[model samples]
Target: MKIATILGTRPEIIKMAPIIDEISKRNIDQIVLHTGQHYDEEMSDTFFRDLDIRTPDYNIQVGSGTHGKQTGLMMKGIEKVLLDEKPDIVLVQGDTNAVLAGALVASKLHIAIGHVEAGLRSFDMTMPEEINRRAADVCSTMYFIPTAESAINLLAEGYSRKNLFITGNTVVDACFRHLKIAKKRGIKEKSLKELNIDKMDNILTLTMHRAENVDVKERVVGIIEALKELDDADIIFPIHPRTKNTLEKFGLFDELNNLEHVHIIKPLGYLDFLLLTSASTLILTDSGGLQEEAITLSVPSLTLRYNTERPETVTAGGNILVGSDREAIVSNARKILDNKNFADKMKNAINPYGQGDSAKLTVDAIEDYHARGLLDIVAPEDIMNSFKRKMKNIREDISVKDFERKENALVHMVFDGKNMQFPTDELNLNGMVINYDKRE
Candidate 1:
C-alpha cells in the first residue's frame, strides 16, 4: 500500500522518525512530504539528518505566517499533491497546520486519513494546536491514541471504537532510540566542548519559544527574571530564533544578554539537545514534547505553560506547572536543587507515555488494516455513522470499561466493498481472526 507521510515541524519530524523507519523495513511504498512550516535548516534539516530520515519527496515551502494564511497556503499546496499521488493513506502526526491541511485535503479527495498522536486535548480552543488536533481527529479514518487517557477522551467525544487504536506515543520511541544513538556517537562530550562549558555536576536547561510566553514583553521579562533567580546551578538556555526575535522586538535582548550564570546559546541540533537534556539537573520549557522527553530521560522538568495536554508527566512528578510566574519558576527550580529526595522521587516515577515499541505497534496496525483491505474506507457521513453503531453494539455486549482494560481483547468487524457486518459475538477467547470473504 502507498502511504503519504506528511510532516512540517521539528517535533513531528522527530516523533515520526521511528514510524518512517518501520515503514521502510516492511518495504511499503512511502512518500515523505514536508510542508516547510518551519523553513530554517537548523530547525528542520538538522533533525532529519540526525535522525537519518529519508528526504521528503515534496516540499510545500509554507514558511511562517499568520495562522489563517499558513493553513490556507498549506491546504492549497497539499491538495495539488494529493490529486497527483492518490496514495492509499495519508499519515499525519501532532497538531501542526500541516497535519490539519493534509487531513482536510485527503478527506476531500476520498483518500484514507490516519492521525498519529490522536485524541489529545488541552480543552483550550484559544490554542491553535487544540483546534488543529480536534479537526484532524474528526477528519481521520483511524485514530492512533497515544495513551489510555487519550483513548478515553476520544471515546467520550463519540468517536467510534473500531477506528480508535491505543498505539502508544511515538515520542517515547524517538527519545529512547535517539538517546542511544547520541551516546554511541559521543555527542555529549562534543556538545559540552563546543559550547565551552565544563561537565558540571548540575546543569539547568531552559527552552522557551511559545508565543504565549515570549511574544509579550512582560511575560518574557518575567521569565528572564525567574531564570536570573536560578543562580545555584549552571543554566544553559537554547534560544529559539522566534524567541530571539521577540526578545529584540520587546527590547529585552540586552537584558537577557547581561545575565551571568546563564549561558545563552543558539538552538541545538537533535543529537546535541538530546545529550544536553539527558545530562540536565532540571529542565524548564513550555514545549509539549519536552515534558514527555524529560519523563523518558528521568530528568525533572518545570513546564512554563499554565496547562498541559500531557498531564501524565505532571502526575508522574517528572514535570511541574510553573507557568511564566517568576516566583513559581524560581521556587520550582529551587525545589529540584534543594530537595534531592523530591528530585529522585520524580526521576523514579512511572513514565506513562509507553515503551519504545510504539512505532512497531503503529506499523503493525497499519499493515493489518492494509492487508485486510480496510485502508480504502473513506470516513464519509454514512460510513462513519455505521461504524459508530457497530461500536455502540460492541459496547453493549462488552462494557467500554472492560474493553479498555482488557489487554488481550480483539476487535472483530468485517467490511466488504461499501458494506459492513457487526457480528459482535462471533469470536470468543480462541483468538480467531475476523474473515472478510468478499471484496470488490
Candidate 2:
C-alpha cells in the first residue's frame, strides 16, 4: 500500500525521519510532502541532510502567515498533492499546521490518516498547537501514541482502543539513532570548538520560539533577564529566526548579546543540535520536543512556559515548568546548576520515552492494520456490536401499548428496506417486559 507522509517544521522532520527510513527498508511506496511552514533553510533543509532523510517529493511552500491564512494555504496545496497522489493512507506527525491541514484534507477525501505522536493535550485553548493537536486527533483513523499516559488521554476522550498503538515515541528512536552518528562524525567536538566552549565549562542550552513567549515584550524581557542572572553557566542559545526578530524588535537583542555568558547562535543542523543537547549541562526552553530530548539525553530541563503538553517529562523528574517569571526561572536554574545532588538526581531519572524501536512498531502496526482492513474510517465489529446492543435496549424499554397510544404511532417500522412488526401482545413481546410475571 502507498502512503503519503506530510511534515513541516524542524521537529516534524526529526521525529518522522526514522519512520521514513523504516518504510524505505520495507520497500513500501511512500511520498514525502513538505508544506514549508518553516521556510528558512536552517530550520528546514538542514534537517533533511542532517537526518539523512530523503528529499521531499512535494513542497507546497506555504511559509509563515497568520494561522488562518497559513492553514488555508496548506489545505489548498495539500489537497492538490493528495488528489494527485491518491495514496492509501496519509501520515502526519506532531501538531504543526501541516498536520492539521493534511489530516483535514485526507479525511475529506476518505483517505485513512495515521497520526504520529497522537493524544497530546495542553488543555489550554489559547495555544495554537493545542488546537492543532486536538483537530488532528479528531481526523485520524490510527493513533501511534508515545506513552501509556498518552493512551490514557485518548481513551478518556472516547477514542477506540483498537486504533491506538503505544509505539513509545519516534523522537526516542531518532535521538538514539542520530546521537551515535553524531559522535561517530565528531560533531560534538566540532560544535564545541566552533562555539569556543571548553569541554569542562558548564553549558545551558536555551531555545525559546513559542509565540506566547516571544510575542510579549514583558515575557521576552523577563526571560532575557533570567538568562542574565544565570552567570555561572555559559548559555548556548540557538536562536530561532522568529525569536531573533522578536528580540531585535523589542530592542532586547543588544542587551542580551552584550551579556558575557549568553552566546546567541543561529539554528544548527539536527545532528549538530543533537550533539549540543547531548553535551549540555542543562536545558532551558519552551519547546515540547526539547523537554523530551533533554530527558532522553539525561539533561535536566527548565521549561520556560506556564504549562506543557509533555507533562511526562516533569513527572519523570527530569524537567520543571518555570514559566516566564524572572524569579522562577532564575531560582530553578540555580537549583539545578548549583546543587550537584539535585543535578545528578535529574540526570539519573529514568527516560520515559522508550527503547528507541518506536519506528519499527509504528510501521509494523500500520502494515498489520492495513492488511486487516482496519485502517479505513468504518465502524469496527466491536463498535457495531455495541451499537446493536444499545438498540436492543431501546427496543425493550418501550411498551407496545405506549407506542400504540401515541398519535400517528405505527405498529411496524422499516429497517434496511424491510418492514418489521412491533410486538403487539405479551406472547409476542418475548421477555422484554420489565415487570411481567407468569403468576399475575
Candidate 3:
C-alpha cells in the first residue's frame, strides 16, 4: 500500500526521518509532503540533507501565516496532494499545525490517517499544539503511540484501543542512528568547538521558536539575558526563523550575533541536532518532543516554558519545569551542574515515552486494523486506563491542577523566559479538560 508522510518544521522532519527511512528500506510506496509551515531553507532543507533523507515528494510551500490561515492553507493544499497521490493512508508526526491539516484533509477525503506520537496531552488546551494533537487523534484511523503510556492515553480518550500500537519512539531511533552516522563519518562537532567547547564538554543546548516567546519585546529580551547567564559551558542555540527575526528586532542581535559564550546559530539539520543533543549535558527548551527525547537519552532538561504536556518526563526526574524564571534558571542550572547524584538518577531513568521503534509497530497495527474491517471503532477503556495511571502517578509525586471555565475568558499562563524554575510537581495534571470528550 502507498503511504504518504506529511511534515513541516524542523522537529517534524527529524521525528519523521526514521519512518521515512524504514518505508524506503522496505521498498514500500512512500510519498512525502512538506507543508512549508516555516519556509526558511535553513530550517527545512537542512534537516532533510543532514538526515540524509530524500527530498520531499512534494513541497507545498505553504509558508508561515496566522494560525487559522496556515492550517487552512495546509488543509487545502494537502487535500489536492492526497487526491493526486491517492495513497492508502497519510502518515503524520507530532502535533504541529501540519499534522492537523493533513489529518483534516485525509479524514474529509475518506483516506486513512495515521497519527504518530499520539495520546499526548499537557492538559492545557491553551496551547495550539494541544488543540492540533487532540483534533488529529479524533480523526486518525491508526495511532503510533510512542509509549505504552501513550496507548493508555488513547484508551481513556475513548479512541480505538485495537489500533493503538506501543511503538518505540521514532525520535530515539533516529537520535541513536544519526549520532552513530555523524561520528563514524567524522562529521566533526566543529560548530560546537567554535563555541569554544572542549572535548567531552557538558553543553547546555537551547532552542526558542514559538511566537509567544518572540512576539513581545520584554519576553525576547528576557530570553537573550537568560542565554547570557549560561556561562563556563557551551550554550549551543539553533534559532528558528521567527525567533531569529525577533532577536534581530530587539537589537540583541549584535550582543549574541557572534558572542563568545552563547553560540547563536541557525537551526541545524536532523543529524546535527541529534549528534549535538546526544553529546549535550542538559537541554533547555519549551519543546514537548525534546522533553521526551531528553528523558530517553538520560540528559537532564530545564524546561524554558511554564508547563508541559509530558508531565511524566518531569515526574520521572529527567526534566525540570522552569517556566522562564530568571533566578530559577541560573540557580537550578548551578544545582544540576554541581550535583552528580541527581544527574545519574535522571540519566538512568526509564523513557516513559517509548523504546524507539514506534513506526514498525504502528504500521503493523494499522494493517491489522484494516484487515479486521473495523474501521468505525473507538476504544475508550484502553485510554481511560492509561490516563488513570498517569493521573495516579502525577497525584502521588506532583501537584495536580484542574481548570474550570471562567465565562468567556481565554486562559493563558505567562512565562518570563526563566530556566527550569517551576517544580515538576506543579505540572502534574490529574487529567485534561478539552472542548469535547470522545469515547469508544
Best by TM-score: 1
**CA lDDT for candidate 1:** 0.80
- Candidate 2: where is the Cα deviation over 4 Å? 43-47, 187-192, 379-440
For model 1, residues 71-139, the per-residue Cα lDDT tens digits are: 999999999988888899999999998999999999888788999999988998999999999999999
> What's the TM for model 3?
0.77
RMSD per model, one decimal: 7.1, 11.0, 9.8
TM-score of each: 0.84, 0.83, 0.77
TM-score preference between candidates 1 and 2, better one: 1
lDDT of 2 by residue, 1-440 (tens): 99899988888888998999999999999999999988876556655776678989999999899999999999999999999988989999989899999999999998999999999889999988889999999999999988767776876575755577888889898899888878777654344458755464799999998989999999998998898899989999888888999989999999999999888887777777887888889999998998999998899999998888899888899999999999999988888888999999999888878889999999999899889977666644643323211112134434545533542232322122232322332223323422211110
**How should the candidates be ordered by TM-score, best one leading?**
1, 2, 3
User: What residue runs in model 1 are displaced by over 4 Å at the alpha carbon?
Assistant: 43-47, 186-198, 378-440
lDDT of 3: 0.72
Model 3 off-target regions past 4 Å? 43-49, 186-193, 216-230, 247-260, 375-440
> Which 10 consecutive positions of candidate 3 have the poorest summed lDDT?
387-396
Candidate 3, residues 1-440, lDDT tens digits: the string is: 78899989877887788788877876888899998887765556665776688899788888888999999989888988899988888898888999999998888888888898888887778888999999999988888876545655666566534466667678777666667777675434456545544474768888777666667667667666766777777788888767877778778778876668677776665555766777788888887878877887788888877777777787778898876677777777777777888778778878776676766666667667656764543444664433221111122322322221212221122112341111111343333222212222
Clashes within 3 Å, all models in order:
0, 0, 20
Query: What shift in Å separates residue 342 of candidate 3 from its native position after superposition?
Result: 1.2
